[model samples]
Every structure is written in structure tokens, then in C-alpha cells.
Target chain A: GAGVSQSPSNKVTEKGKDVELRCDPISGHTALYWYRQRLGQGLEFLIYFQGNSAPDKSGLPSDRFSAERTGESVSTLTIQRTQQEDSAVYLCASSPRGGTGANSPLHFGNGTRLTVT
Target chain B: AQSVAQPEDQVNVAEGNPLTVKCTYSVSGNPYLFWYVQYPNRGLQFLLKYITGDNLVKGSYGFEAEFNKSQTSFHLKKPSALVSDSALYFCAVTSGNTPLVFGKGTRLSVIA
Candidate 1:
């Protein structure tokens, strides 16, 4: 609908396998973000795409985690060779502006619950 | 650099009683603070925000937050509690060009 949409509501993957999570941000939104939430924990910022600007990959845990956004449209987060520690809920959010607007609160998707075993 | 902290891991309140979830932040410049609630198996829902204007901001679901600059605090409050309010609440902050940093979240359980 109008809100951000994420695919594969739940995923179970064997260790050492690869998985790709998709996110469809709200139409016309300039900022798209990805975050990881561990069980009963807080959100860990993964990455964010603002328009055509180079995405901020500072929050990525390691080389195994990466993401891509196509012209502010759909985005994909790929975890290569996932490990048991990679299990968590991956959330996607979108906002009208990047990080400077007073009215740019993020709209989030239900998120993908990933299980690595 | 910007950061947020939710001191309490959980808060329990009786129905019809006032409730508060404490939050504190540290930012280099003016802080953009926000509150979000997460229900069971759901994504985070925006509650309210404090950007610049008023210190007290009203938001969805009969919730309000007070931004105290001097104290570096933005605490969420509600006059009366509802059992439906029992969920995980997260506090977040952003400053300048920094991405939003979230707190470890506080669970609010409103008993009936």
C-alpha cells in the first residue's frame, strides 16, 4: 500500500547460505533505511539511501552484509554466507527527507524475521 | 555523533494510572528526537517527535512527550494507561546529517 513494504515476512536459512531481503519504500520518498533488531534489543542501523547520494554503509556489521537501492525505488539487503549470529529482524523505513527535516518521521515496514541455523 | 538512551528496560502501570518512559540523548547540535511503539509482530509506529518549536509535543494514541533541553531528556507520558499500550517503546535521535540512533527500548505493560 502507501507504506513501506518488505518481502519474505519470515525466512529460515541454513548457516553459510546467502539470502536477499527486499524493501519497497513509499513512492516519492527520498530516504530509505535498513536496520537490524536483535531479540528483545534495540535497532541497529544498517544502511540508508538518500536519493542518489552514496549510501551510508557505516552501520554494516562486516563484509558479508551489503545493500543496494535503485534510484530510490526498491532496495535489497544481501547477507552473504550468513551465520547463526546473523539472525534478527530486518526492518525497512522511508522518509520524505534524509536527516534534516522537522517533519520527516520515518514510515516503516513490518520487517523480515530472519532465522539462521 | 548522536545517541539515545532509555534507562528503564520495562515499565508497569495499572490501568487509568499515569505512565512515563524516560529517555535521554546526546547530540552535537539540536536534537531531533522521536518516539515509536512496536506491537506484537509489527513494525515500529511513529508516536511523536520534538524538532524545534514547543517543548511538549502531542502525538498519536493519546501520547505526549516533553522535550527538556537543559536536562537532555525527552520522556514519553500518558495520563491514563491502556492494556493495549503494553508493547516495546523505542526512543531515537538524530542531529545534523547523522542517521537516527535508537535506544535499547523499554517495554510498557499496562495492567488492567
Candidate 2:
């Protein structure tokens, strides 16, 4: 209730399969972000949505990675033809607002561990 | 573009001793710096942030960070260390409307 929430904490899939990870941001939050974290690696930015509009999408590793948001409430990240390299923990975060980067601390979800075999 | 750097991959500090985790940033204009901690099997928890004014900002769990304007650095410090404090610490920065960009992370080990 006090933070962001993500569904299906652990997801395991075989290679070439498709998976959908969901993120339910904090109520009333307007900025949401999607990131991927490989084992022993830093967080890799995926996409950012501000009020259903994504201004920067260059972080997507490939065209296989896609994400969408609706009315600033929920966001879904879809990975198609997933490969073994896609195995990692996917994280989601939200803030009160976007654009200025000041006075806004991102609240994060526990993350969804995605394992592609 | 804004970026954060955590030079150390791992930091080892003895219990009861003070600890420091270094961070630096590069941004086009003013930089917003933050520190977050991740315990085992837990989501990243925000520790503190440096927005403006205060050079030293206190945060949860007795952690504090100093923002140095000239050095362009925001280093996290604690007067004393605890074993439970051992975790993965990340430094992040945000400028303009871009999403917060994180550093590679520094694994802090507070040995008891």
C-alpha cells in the first residue's frame, strides 16, 4: 500500500517464448520506468512513460522489448521471442511527477525475476 | 545527458567503524543525486537524495550523503557501520525530464 507493486515475482520460461511482466505503480503517480537487471550487472534502462507518453525509448535493448502504459496507472512490459540472455530481474519504479527530477524520489517494486532457459 | 558513477565495485568496512561509498555525476545542468540500498532478495530502498541547499542530507538507517558542487560528487557516509548494513548500494542521477540513471552499484560489506 505504501509502495509500488509488481506481479508474478518469479517467472521462468524457455527460450524463444514470450513473457509479460506487469507493474502497478503507486496510486496517482505520473512517471513510471522499466528497467532490466542482469545478475551481477547494473540496472539497464528499458523505457519511460510520462502520462502515457514515452519521450525516450532508446534504452530498449531490441525491438523484441516493448512496453505500454494506460492512464498512468498500470504498465505492461512484453518481451517477444525471449532468449536466454533475457534472464534477469525486471524492476519498476514510479514517482510523484516527472520532467524536473527535483524533489521526486522513485519508489521501486520488488522486481520480477525472469529466467529464460 | 546525466550519468552516475560508483567507482568501487566492492567496499569492505569493519563494524563500528565509519564507512564511505563514493559517487560522482555528470549532467548538463543541475544534478539530482540519490542513494539506494538493496538487501538480499529485496527491492531497492531509497536512502537519501541531494536536491539543493543542504550539503549533507540525512536518510534512513543512519546513512547520510554529502553533495560537493565543485567535485560534482555525492558521497554516502555513515558515522558507524553495522553488519545488517551490508548490501548493494547504488548511486543514481537525474537531470531534466529523463528517467533516473543508475550507476553500476557498489557492494558494501560491513564485517562484524
Candidate 3:
């Protein structure tokens, strides 16, 4: 794809339901990231995947928020037993190189807006 | 821990006038700073980055950012403003190989 792509641009789920968001990064990009954006807050880092290495789950807000990536391609973010506070935009970004180094800017997807009712 | 700050929640500028969006960051080691823009119903687009050397770095769409290590600031600037440039701007920072930490976005509104 010419740019990063995400599925179901908007989602509204009931509280306590599980929701999954998908992300397809640009071809050949080795690094991917997930972030959460609240109604009026900044983008909050959720998780990061670099190649086959263990993903950096340090940013996950809680155990309910989990993500998985296959190889260096598609990735999915799952929020189990979603709560009203989980309502936010889930963003996915990919870069040709890892987070470090110059000239490696992240290309982002339009993001999935998750709303918990 | 690494963090970035975009002080102004909104900035208003007239078309054809120079514009600036302020940013500041804090990190342990050498800071790698970045700027990104988000348009309505669109994803964030990378503007520029500052890694090392030349304090002034040029980026897409005729945008530029200056890295000030002493003040720990990386402010985005444009020689002229365009109404189309109105969007949400974000500043981010990363140290070593950590995930990028972003700041609360600043909304830029350029009046025609």
C-alpha cells in the first residue's frame, strides 16, 4: 500500500466488550507502533514492535490492552473487557527504520476511533 | 523518561505571514526531536526531525525546525503561512532506542 492502512475507521462497542483494531503498515517497514489518543489528550504510546524482537509492551496502559504483530507486516491491538475510559482513537504508525536514528519518520494511518457506550 | 511539550493549545496566523509553533523536550541522552501534522479526518504526516549536526533541519511542505539543545527546544517554523496549513501539530522526542514520546498537539489555524 502507498500508506499505512487501518480497518473500521470508527467502532462503537458496549462496555465490557472486547474490541480489536487492525493495522497494515507500509511494505518493507521494519518498525511499527500503537498509540491511543483520548478526546483532548496527546497521543499516548501503547506498544512498539521491531522486527522479530520481543515487542516493547512497556507503554500498554493495562493488561486488558494487548497487541500482536506477525513478522513485520500486519498488527492487531485488542482491548479486552473494554471500559468507557477506553474510548479513544487507536493509531498505528510504521517507520522504515527503528525509532532511533535520523530520517526515519513514522508514517501513520487514519486510526480507528473506538467508542465504548 | 522522555517527554515533549507543546505549550499552546491553539495558534492563529494570517495567510502569507511567517508562523511558528513552539516545542520543548526533556530526555537523558542526545534528543531526537520530530514534528508531525494531522489534518481533519486524516493521519499524522511527518514534518521533520533533528538528530545531530546542523541545528536547523528542513522538512516536507516547506516547514523547518530548529533544535536548541541548551534550551531543550525544537520549534517548527515556516517562512509563510497558508490556510491549508491549518492543522494539528505535534512534537515528539526519543532517546536511545525508546519509543517516541509525544506532546499534546497544538492546533494551527491560518486565516485567509
Candidate 4:
């Protein structure tokens, strides 16, 4: 319960449907991240939220992908009109904001395995 | 910009034998290297990290990684392999306040 937690550990949806994945980061952690891992591929950064500042959506592959973190607590990643290519394990990680001193590694959750059929 | 590379896609080692999983990095400044393992249908589990200090850093599950600045590598090592240790291993690197960049990952299969 102390580590990051993600909802809907496994999701199966029809293509072109919208889906939202939720992430509950560790309490007191200000930085939350989203990543996607396709079969046989590395984890790809999706979006990041650091405290109250604007989220960095540079890693988002397309406009259909977006995320929001409310008050440094919980975050949601939404994929609009998901395609088969969107099938992958969506991972969530959390860490303390800033450099690697007191805040070193990012703790990850079990992740949501999204399968778009 | 920072990047990590795991040259081998898979590693095979017999139980009780020493194991090495190679990892290389490309970063602008001092690299913050980390190793994580993933079991089937599971998230990445933290193994160990190299921030500064020592070149050889010990991590969880009897694993260690050697940070070689000159070679730009942070290869994971274990004195003795275990069958339970078989999993997908990833190497990650970060520079500045950027997000962690991960390698493709190497599947370690320890045979009994």
C-alpha cells in the first residue's frame, strides 16, 4: 500500500474507444510519471507532473494522449479513440520533486495492461 | 539528453554461476544510472542505482552494478545466479531534472 498504485490492472477495450487510467502516487511525493511499455520494447515516457507547475507532455506520442494530476495527489492518463497500436502496459511511477539527493529513484506500480482489440 | 542501452536482448546463465548484464549510457552531465527488474505482468522493480560516490553499488536481490565513467557503462552483476532471478532487466539513466530514460531491457534466464 505504500508504493504507487494503479487502477484497472488489466483493461480490454474495443478500438476507437476512450479510456482513462488512474494512478495514486505515494503520499507526499510531488512528482508523478506515466510510461508505456509495448511487448518486447522499453518503457516509453508519456507525461510527467511535478507539483503545481505545468505538466511536461513532451513524451506524449499524439494529441489523443493527455494526462492530469490534481493537487500533487492522484493523476489520470486519458487516451482518446484508442487504436490497436495503443495496446501496452501503462506504468505509473512517483518520486519526490527535484534532483537525486533525498529524492533518488522513482517507485513504480504494478501497471495497467491495456489491450485494444 | 540522456539514453541507456542494453546490448544483449537475453542472457543465459546456469544457477550458481556469475552473471553479468551489460548496460551503457549517454548523458550530458554526471549520469544517474539505475537498474530495475520486471517479472511477468509486473511493474519495474528497483534493483540498484549509481548516483555518485562509489563505482560499484550494491542493490536488492543480491545484485550489484559497476559504474564505469570512462567506459560510460553501468553493468549489473551477481556473484551467483538464481532461477528466481530470471526476468526482464532494464537500465535507466537520468540527467538534470529530466525523466528517467530506459533501455530496451535484457531477459535473464537462469537455468537450474
TM-score of chain B of each: 0.98, 0.97, 0.98, 0.98
The local lDDT score (0 to 100) that residue B54 gets in candidate 2 is 83
DockQ of 2: 0.67
Residue B3's lDDT within candidate 1 is: 81
Writing each residue's lDDT as its tens digit, candidate 1 over B9-93 gives 9899999999999999999988889999999888899999988899999999999999999999999999999999999999999
- Candidate 4, residues B1-112, lDDT tens digits: the string is 7788899999999999999999999999888889999987677888898888989999999999999999999999999999999999999998857888899999999999
- What would the C-alpha RMSD of candidate 3 be, to one decimal place? 1.2
Which 10-residue window of candidate 2 chain A scores lowest in summed lDDT? A97-106
Candidate 3 lDDT over B40-103, as tens digits, reads: 9889988898888999999999999999988999999999999999999999998868888999
What are the models' TM-scores? 0.97, 0.95, 0.97, 0.96
DockQ by candidate, in order:
0.67, 0.67, 0.69, 0.59
TM-scores of chain A across candidates: 0.95, 0.93, 0.95, 0.94
Cα distance off (Å), candidate 3, residue A17: 0.4
Q: Taking the tens digit of each residue's C-alpha lDDT, what string does model 2 give over B1-112?
A: 7788899999999999999999999988888888989999899988999877889999999999999999999999999999999999999888755778899999999998
Model 2: fnat (fraction of native contacts): 0.62
Q: Which stretches of candidate 1 lie over 4 Å from their true place?
A: A98-102
Looking at candidate 2, what is the lDDT of residue A6?
Answer: 97
Provide the clashing-pair count of each candidate structure.
0, 0, 0, 0
The true-versus-predicted C-alpha distance at residue B82 of model 2, in Å, is 1.1
| C-alpha root-mean-square deviation, each candidate | 1.2, 1.4, 1.2, 1.5
Estimate candidate 1's RMSD in Å. Answer: 1.2
